[model samples]
Target: MEPRWLSQDEQESWLPFAAMLIKLPAALDAQLQRDADITHFEYLVLARLSMIRDRTLRMSELASVVSASLSRLSHVVKRLEQRGWVRRAPCPENGRFTNAILTEAGWEKVVATAPGHVEEVRRLVVDALSESELRQLREISSRVLQRIDPDAGTW
Candidate 1:
């Protein structure tokens, strides 16, 4: 068997793609930590929970939303729990499952942090692209995500 290799065009595209993957998260995290005292991942977890009617999600579902391991999500939620932003309890419907519930303070934190985060996101990524570019970016992201996790549901 011969080793498969990236062609020149593939290599060229990957360079910038990989760089953006590295740089974008760092930039987003810096803004989040400085303004909201939360990392981007934590913000994502909170944001996802906030959009639900109950502001709560089963722990396993949350791990999927954040694309995190169960262990990692548990650790992060514990930190949020200590801050009085979220609580973990056994699901009443199914004691086998744990639920992560956003507290009043967590909702307030999301409300406070969202506007600034939105502005920064627009300034950094959305504003830099045209309408067509935005659509193209979405398509590109979806294609890559499908390749990575075919069983994944919409987030």
Candidate 2:
């Protein structure tokens, strides 16, 4: 079988898109490291946890929300727990399930860290686009994400 190589137009568009995929995470992580002493992924986990009611989520649901593996999130959560930001407990509704609960300190951490993180995000990505462009970017990214993980309903 033969491969379907990209056309020149496709290649041109893909080149920059691929570069963004490579660089964006690093850029965000660097900003987070300098300002918050945490990686962007950690910020995401904490921020997501803070948003939900009760500031808690099932371990599996948290993993899915962050688009990470359970093991990976567990490691991050462990670090957070060590920092007094999060605690884990058996789910009230299901004895076999566990929940990650954000502590008071965790809420404070999120509140403290959010502004700088948001500023960096705006500086790096959001402010670079016009209003219309922002909408288009969301639509386009959603399309690509649909293709990448078609069964992901939450995204």
Candidate 3:
């Protein structure tokens, strides 16, 4: 079956959204690299670890939460390990699995970087939207995400 082309209105709306999807991550990555000496994905991985109990999470779980492939996560984890920001140890309950544990230095680094990251996020996104528009955008985004990944609800 042939795919239906977008209508003019759809194209107009999608253009900016598509541009945002491409540009926003790049901008965030650039800011993080400059300010934190880490890529945005690394920040995300660390941030996710920060949020977990004991500042530790299984590799697979971390990969899922960060939307990263295991191999990609492994490489990033290795980098973090080299920096003494993260450590890997055999899971206590399951020896076959490994857990990523955030070090004190990692926690401190993320804590220091968070305010700047939050400021950047606000500057780039939140501050531009009205309260009602932000709510509406959240709802729309949730629906779109659900449609894109049915299993995403587990997160």
Candidate 4:
């Protein structure tokens, strides 16, 4: 079968998007590293846990939420544990599965880090877009995500 290729207009659209995929993570990581002494992914793991009701989640579920592998999450969690920011234990409901729980320190870390992080996000993304462009970006990203994985739910 012949492969379908991007047309000129499609290529023009995709190039900037592709560059953003490369640049944005580095930019966010840089800010997080400089301000909080954490990587963006680490901050994400902490922030996501903070958002949950109990500040706990099963390892597998947390991995899915962060789009990470269990091994990677476990390693990060280990580092967090060393910092007294997170803890891990067998889930009470199912002993076979482990749960990651944010400690008081972890919550505090998120609280302290969030303002700077939010400011960076706002300055880089939100402030750069008009309201209409923001809506369009959201819609376009959602559509792309749906196409990539129809079963995936919003975060």
Candidate 5:
């Protein structure tokens, strides 16, 4: 079957979106690296772990939450472990499972870094949009995410 080419308007919109996909992660990583000595992905993992009950989450659950493969998460977790930021323990309920727990030091690091990260987010994305535009952007993004991953589970 022949593919339908994008219209000019779609092309223009997609170009910026594609560029953003490529650039945003790099930019975010750079900022985190400068301020926290961590990659954006590592910060994300740490941040997610921080939010979970008991400041811990099962490895598989963490992988799913971060949309990362087990192997990928393992490597990242290993690095975090080295930094004294996280530790892995055998899950109490299931010996076969492991849980990633954010350490006190890790929590402190995240707490210290969060303000800078939030400022970066505001400066880079939020501040660029008007109040109405921000709302519309959130609605659009939520709809697109739901369509892309219908069974993505809870927010």
Candidate 6:
């Protein structure tokens, strides 16, 4: 069968979106690295932990929350551990699973880093969009994410 293809209009729309997928992360990561000495993914792991109860999450659950593989998360967690930002141990409730717990230092780092990150995000995205456009952007992203992974909800 002949393949379905994006028409001219669809191609025009897709081009910018595809470029954004690459550029946005790089820009965010660059800001985090410069200001916080952390990569964007590291910030995400810490931020996610900061929001949870006890600042603790099972390793697998943390991976899911961060949209990372367990192996990749483990490596990042290892780096965090070395910086005294995070620690891993057997889950008290279930020794078969490990838990990632944010340390006091990790919490402090998140608190300190968040302002600069938020400012950068606001400068780059939030402040650029009108209220209606912001809502439309959210709706459009949700639809695309649903198509990409039906089980994974929007971030």
Name the top lDDT candidate: 6
Report lDDT per candidate: 0.95, 0.94, 0.94, 0.95, 0.93, 0.96
**lDDT, candidate 4, 24-103, per-residue tens:** 98999999999999989999999999999999999899999998999999999999999999999998787899999999
List, residue by residue over 40-102, the lDDT tens digit for candidate 6.
999999999999999999999999989999999999999999999999999878889999999
lDDT of 5 at 47: 93
Off by over 4 Å in 1: 153-155
Alpha-carbon shift of residue 14 in model 4 (angstroms): 1.6
- Residue pairs in steric clash, candidate 2? none
Candidate 5 local accuracy as lDDT? 0.93
lDDT of 5 by residue, 1-155 (tens): 99999999999999999999899888888999999899999999999988878999999999998999999999999999999999999988889999999999999989988889989999899998899999999898889989998987376
Root-mean-square deviation of Cα positions for candidate 3 versus the true structure, in angstroms? 1.2
Candidate 3 wrong stretches, greater than 4 Å: 1-3
Comparing 2 with 5 on TM-score, the higher-scoring candidate is: 2
* Tens-place lDDT digits, model 2, residues 1-155: 89999999999999999999999999999988998899899999999999999999999999998999999999999999999999999987889889999999999999999999899889989999999999999999889899998888565
TM-score list, all predictions? 0.93, 0.95, 0.95, 0.92, 0.92, 0.94
Residues 40-98, candidate 3, lDDT per residue (tens digit)?
A: 99999999999989999999999998999999999999999999989999998989899
Q: Candidate 5, which segments miss by more than 4 Å at Cα?
A: 153-155
**Candidate 4: Cα lDDT at 78:** 97
